[model samples]
Target chain A: MRHHKALFKFAIKAGEIMLRNGAETYRVEDTIERILRTQDLEIVESFVTPTGIFATMDEEDGETVTVVKRVRKRTIHLHKVALINHLSRQFVEGSLTLEEASQTLQEIESRKPYPPAIMIMSIGLAASFFTVVFGGSLRDFCSSLLIGIFLALLQQGFYNSRVSRFLVDLLGGSLIAVFALLFVNTGLGAQLDKIIIGSIMPLVPGVAITNAVRDTIEGDLVSGISRGVEAFFIAVSIAAGVGIVLKIWFAVNGGYIV
Target chain B: MILPMALQIISAFFATIFFSVMFNISRKELLYCGLSGGLGWSIYLISNQLGGSIVVSTFLGALAVSFLSRYLAILRKQPVTIFLISGTIPLVPGAGMYQTMYALITQDIEQAATYGSQTLQMAGVIAIAMIIISSLPKSAPEQRKAH
Candidate 1:
């Protein structure tokens, strides 16, 4: 009974790491099942969602151990997912034991994300490059780079304030539009469209949209629909923020096509 | 023209690498992620220049990215999502969505509907392209041996 409990706990731990790292539902469930099966456990079943994991292991002597883990926050850290996948494979191959695998998982869970300053710089670079890819002029690229840096700092401020994700995105989009408009009016850039589009790339929900489609195809209907709605609202919020700023600009300019 | 096209591809590469860094992809896998993004963007640009509609270009671009990410995953022993998500960044319809919203804000109903539907169709086609690639069976020895 003690051994069964330990193995089950380990399986759930693996699932927890993957789920919290923004893995799809099917991948998490498969990892849990594979981990438990390698231990020679019979009748192992796992159900995973975007927010939780449920699994049960049944032994021949009528011993059953069920584990449930709720994952509250999900961030993109594919490295952790890949690391856990490698550890699970090693454990299944008989090289590592449960204790070592769990220890490694703990270490990964506690690992800090990249420093804020580096992340902000990366966002600025991405925005600048995206502007160039979208056919912005050199002037527009410089403007986007500067505005992107300011947007990152503003986002960090919102993050520290513990505001909801929706509000942050809304404000971020408005801020981008406002800055881009300011630059264009000051003769720093010629194209408002390109500048705004470039800065908005960092806020777009590319992952959510992809995962929503993939989840729906995988028949995880609940997760699929929820993610779809989340993506939809994010798009709406971005559009709304940009629309509000554009409207304000239009009114101020007396509807002139400047 | 050729120089501009090359610059665009290179910029796409750096943009994807930056996003990969933002997502915490390991440094070892960063180059592959950038390649995936650059290749996808170049394909989209070429197709668009060749008179392909936005929907067609986006679909082709996403299909290439998905297939490349799978192959890279086999070689690098990393999860497919590591490359897949970052690679798809360049092909997403950020500009189209913005144009649609701008049209609506300016009270141009016809333009709004046009851009809005174009964005929806492009999104749908990209999803279809991804589904098609993911459904294909992998016969590569490396992938077969990994399982």
Candidate 2:
């Protein structure tokens, strides 16, 4: 039992190290596998976080069980590590405070909303819904809000940033474009504000700013700025498409465009 | 959405906790960070409902977050970033940006500029709010240090 606790602590420590270094999700898993293999330990299941690790393992497996293991090779440039080493050279010098080191590792951790990120996404959704219902006319509010909420809650393959950032941006922009194209021309034109803002809020990079700052602090200014610019443009394009449609409507029929 | 709103609040509540855990913050210090955010945003929504301008409401909302975060850092203990980030989510200028673009596409250069300005205003509102909220606590001490 005592040995189990000790191994568990070591596993956790190993997790903390990976997380702090900014290992992406799969990278973190590989790191843990490396640690377990080094210790000649048995593994059950492993998972990664923006923070650290969660895993279940038992040494008793050494007594009788054999499990098939699968491996894949992934290449990563430990940007965060080189960053920390460079920054530490400027200020404190020598070793990093465990916190700094851990954060650096977590920086390497690939992008995903830790569960709270999802909640933030959801709450922002709720807030958007509430904003429309309370502020705008009910009919315009509902249709636009429904579109916004659906886009947010859909959680389709659009969530994959690497595969679909541009695609999702295009789709989101086009969807809003189509909605505005169809409705803004009609007698009951909707609240453009409600439709555009509420729908696109889920994808904004408030988190990216926080991460970018961490990166800048750790000395990866180029990468940090690039990510920030990329995120900012995706947001801008989402707005641009919808804006174009609304502009056309205003030209055809002169009225206050909200 | 059913009970997901409440669940979201709960998730946000613990998300900060998870951040704290990873960042090496004390466990006891987490909930205040979440509360500070929720409270600030609630106030922003309430004031906006009462006919305050979005700009004014957002400023006050950010102030509310920063104030409590600063107070909690003194009375309790936690990073201001947690509450500030979470609180600012409600204020991010999403609507304004859309309106600006919508104005642009239809060739209403004037209105596009107008709403574009509004979007800029909104973005400015959040940007300043972010700077203020993040700096409010430090400003106090920095002032005294200069004196």
Candidate 3:
């Protein structure tokens, strides 16, 4: 009974790490069930959604243990997801002891994301390269590079705040538009639309949209719908942010700036 | 035209690499992510130049990315999402979404409707492509069958 309880803790902890780091719902459930089944539990079932995990392990001759882990925070850190995936597979394959697995999970959980400077530079370069992809010229690329860096700085500033993610995106969209407009109006950039589009790419909900579809297709209706709504709201917020700024600009300039 | 397409593909490669960095994908897998992105964008460009509709081209691009991600998931022994998320970044209709919002803000309702539907279609097709690829049988399902 004690061993079963420890195993349950390990499995749920692994699932929690995966969930909090943005693994898909199905994957988390699979990992938890796999971990629990390593001990020959007669009935092991796990239910995961975008926000929480519920699992029960029933042994034929032993007590049944149920665990519920509520996951509230999420960010895109695929490396952590992949690491837990590897760790769970190892534990299932019998190569890793329970203690080792728990220790590794702790390490993975405590792992920090890439340094802020590198992330900022990457974000800036991503925006600039996307400008080129969208047929922007050298001048437009330069402006987007600056805008992307500024946007990254803004995001870093908000990284520790308790602000809502959608509001951050809304602010991000407005920031991109504001900078794009500033550059164009000042003759430092050409093609306002291209710059805004490129800079906004960083803030789009690609992960949420993809995961929502994947979850839905895998028959996790609850997770799918919730993630889909998340994607929709994010899209709407970004659009609203950009729309408000452009509307004000249009009204002030008496015409379309582009 | 070919030169421009090549430029777009190369930029996609680097852009995906940088995006992967933001996603905290490991350094070892960054190159593969970049390759997947470049491959997907190349397909998008070629199909678009071949007169495919934007939606159809996005579907093909996403299809290619999904297959590549599955393959790399096996080859590199990593989760498919690492590659899929970054690979599909370029095809996620950010431009279309922006265009739609632009039209709406400018009170061009007709154009807004057109772009908005196109954006949704592109997103839908990408999802369908991923589903098709993921649902395909794996090499050794007997292991999964054991459960």
Candidate 4:
């Protein structure tokens, strides 16, 4: 009985980590089932969504344990997900004990994010390179690099300010458009369109779109539609942000054509 | 012409590395992620050069990236999402989305609808590519089935 209890706890812990780290709904359920089957539990069922996980384990002794975990925050940290995935596989293979598996899960949970300097530098480089791939010239690349760096710093500031996510996205979009327009109007870069597209690449909802499709295909209609809505709004907000800024630019310059 | 193509692949490489860093992928696997992205982008560029439609190019590009991610996942023993997410980043329709929005702002309703539909179709094709690649059973199913 005690072993089953510990195993149940460990299974939920693993699922929690996977879910918080942005594993898809189906993957989370599969991982939990695998971990629970490590023991002789007769019944192990798990259901996971983007925001919650509910699982139950029943043994032949007529004992049942259930756990409900509400996941409030979701981020893209594949390192944590990978580590937990490795740990769960090890446990299921019977090489690791219950206590050890739980301990490892704790360690994975507290893993640190990449250094801020590294993140800022990478974002800047990504934006700049995306510009080049999209047909921007050398001058345009340099200009977008500056814009990317600025946007990265701006995003870092917004991370801790407790601002709403929608507002941040809207402002970020407008900022990209305004900066690109300013640079082009000042003759700093020859292409405003390329600059804006490159700078906004990081803000696009690539993961959300992918996850939505995967979830829907896996028969999780709720998570699929919710993630799809989330991606749609992100696209809309970015567009609205850029459109508002462009409208203002046109009005201010008395409709000076592009 | 060749120089620009090389530069495009290099840029895609760097872009993938940067994105992988943001996701905090472990240090050892960083280079592979970048390679996957570069390979996918090269496929995209080459197919575009061969006169494929945007939908076809994106579909092929994402297919390559997804297959590569699966291979890398087995080799590295990590989750496929690590490589798949960053590798497929280059194929997302950010440019089309922006063009649609810009058209709307300029009061070009017809142009806005055209670009909007194009963007939607690109997204649909990319999703299909991801779905087809991810559904393939890995080789370890025998072991999984034993349990």
Clashes (N, CA, C under 3 Å) per candidate: 0, 22, 0, 0
Model 4 clash pairs? none
RMSD of 4: 2.0
Q: Pick the candidate with the highest DockQ.
A: 1
Q: What share of the true interface contacts does each candidate keep?
A: 0.76, 0.17, 0.87, 0.83
Against the native complex, each candidate's DockQ, computed on alpha carbons, is 0.77, 0.12, 0.76, 0.71
lDDT of 3 by residue, A1-258 (tens): 777878889999999988988789999999999899888668899999999999998856767778878888788889999999999988998999999999999999999999999999999999999998998889999999999999999999998899998999899989998999999999999999999888988888888998898889889999999999999999999888888889889899898888
Candidate 1 residue-wise lDDT at B143? 53
Q: What lDDT tens digits, residue by residue, belong to model 4 across residues B1-147?
A: 789999999999998888888778899999999999999999998998899988899889999998998888877777778888889889989999989988887889999999899899988887898889878775684235221
Alpha carbon lDDT of each predicted model: 0.85, 0.49, 0.91, 0.85
For candidate 3, the per-residue lDDT at B142 reads 25
TM values, all candidates: 0.95, 0.51, 0.97, 0.95
Q: Which candidate has the highest TM-score of all?
A: 3
**Residue-level lDDT tens digits of model 2 in B17-42:** 33233222333554665576556656
* Model 1 spans > 4 angstroms off: A59-63, A160-162, A256-258, B142-147
Query: Fnat of candidate 2, please?
Result: 0.17
Task: Rate residue A166 of model 4 by lDDT.
Answer: 73
